[model samples]
Target: MTSSPAAEDGVVRADVWLWAARMYKTRSIARQAIDGGKVDLNGHAVKPARSVRAGDVFELTRGNERIEVRVLAVSERRGPAPDAALLYVETERSIARRQAEVALRRQHAGAPRPPGRPDKQDRRLLQRLKKSIRD
Candidate 1:
């Protein structure tokens, strides 16, 4: 695994650090979220290039989960899962909220789902109906 550019300085770019920590699968995606305001530092939105160091706090939202974590270590390298886990400490409140959200989703798991993929004819019919209504 290669280390990030800023790893030698004891700080890393927020996007790089987030990817390194396993918060997002890719640095580009993390940068996009940061640009879209889905992640914040100390309650204010931050740029993807913002530097992150140990003890910095982050609030990241993805789908139904909002995580608040304090940076425990800054590493530029994308390491193993266990090592990645050591990068940040999640807040207790954040943990509790995630658990509650998981439980709520589990309760809805029995809801009905569509039978299968819509066929080409069904797609054509839907398109015609939508066009007719719009016209």
Candidate 2:
């Protein structure tokens, strides 16, 4: 396997790095996230082409998860999962927060849910409640 460019140049573009590190499935998705403001580098919003170096911190939001990672290395080419994992390290606070979120979600998972679509009588009752609130 080829060594990462990080060892030679010590820098890579934000989107490329994200893809290479397995943070996103594709470079385009990484670019979209950067453009859509779902990514922040070193505490500031960064463009796809922004230079990323070792020790740079990143805050990324993917779906319902918020992640904070510190770049431990940079790579221009995608690699194996183990190699990708070596590219960055998730912060302790981020791990704790993600665990807490999972626990909270699990706690709410057992909540009693409505059986199904409301019947006509239930709809009428909801309408009445809405009307009362509006009055």
Candidate 3:
């Protein structure tokens, strides 16, 4: 392996922190996730250049699950999953709630929807939009 950390403790970049934390598979994915507005820095959207410090909280959305983690350490080269885990602290509440939501969503995927014809409201909206766009 060949690498040197650009940061000492808290001077790490946001993408680097995200990758080291194992939030995303690759640093490029972390950057793309950041660019796609799937990741937040201290409750706001941030680019890859954003700085991270110890104790800073992050809100990351990878689908319907929202994960909240606090920065504990920072590293550029992702160490083993065990070592990478030291870089962040996850909250129990967030984990439990996310798990429950995931389970519920999975359970409901095959559930049948009420059998009915399309609603009139949908037709009206579709036609109205079509007419408006013709102008």
Most lDDT-accurate candidate = 2
User: What lDDT would candidate 2 get against the real structure?
Assistant: 0.95
Q: Which scores greater on TM-score, model 2 or model 3?
A: 2
- The lDDT for every candidate, in the order shown, is 0.91, 0.95, 0.85
When sorted by TM-score, best at the front, the candidate numbers are: 2, 1, 3
Q: How close is candidate 2 to the true structure, as a TM-score?
A: 0.93
Indicate the worst ten consecutive residues by lDDT in candidate 2: 1-10
Model 2 CA lDDT for position 24: 96
lDDT of 2 by residue, 1-135 (tens): 676555478988999999999999999999999999999999999999899999999999999999999999888889899999999999999999999999999999999999999999999999999999999
Query: Highest TM-score: which candidate?
Result: 2
Candidate 2's displacement at residue 97, Å, is 0.6
What is the Cα-based lDDT of residue 103 in candidate 1? 91
Pull out the clashing pairs in model 1: none
Q: Which candidate would rank higher by TM-score, 1 or 3? A: 1
Model 1, 37-73: lDDT tens digits are: 9999988889988989898999999876899999999
Write down the RMSD of all candidates, one decimal each: 4.7, 2.0, 5.7
Ten contiguous residues minimizing lDDT sum, candidate 1: 1-10
Candidate 1: regions farther than 4 A off:
1-6, 110-135
**How high is each candidate's TM-score?**
0.74, 0.93, 0.72
In model 2, where do residues sit more than 4 Å from their true spots?
Answer: 1-7
Error of 3 at 94 (Å): 1.3
Residue pairs clashing in model 3 are none
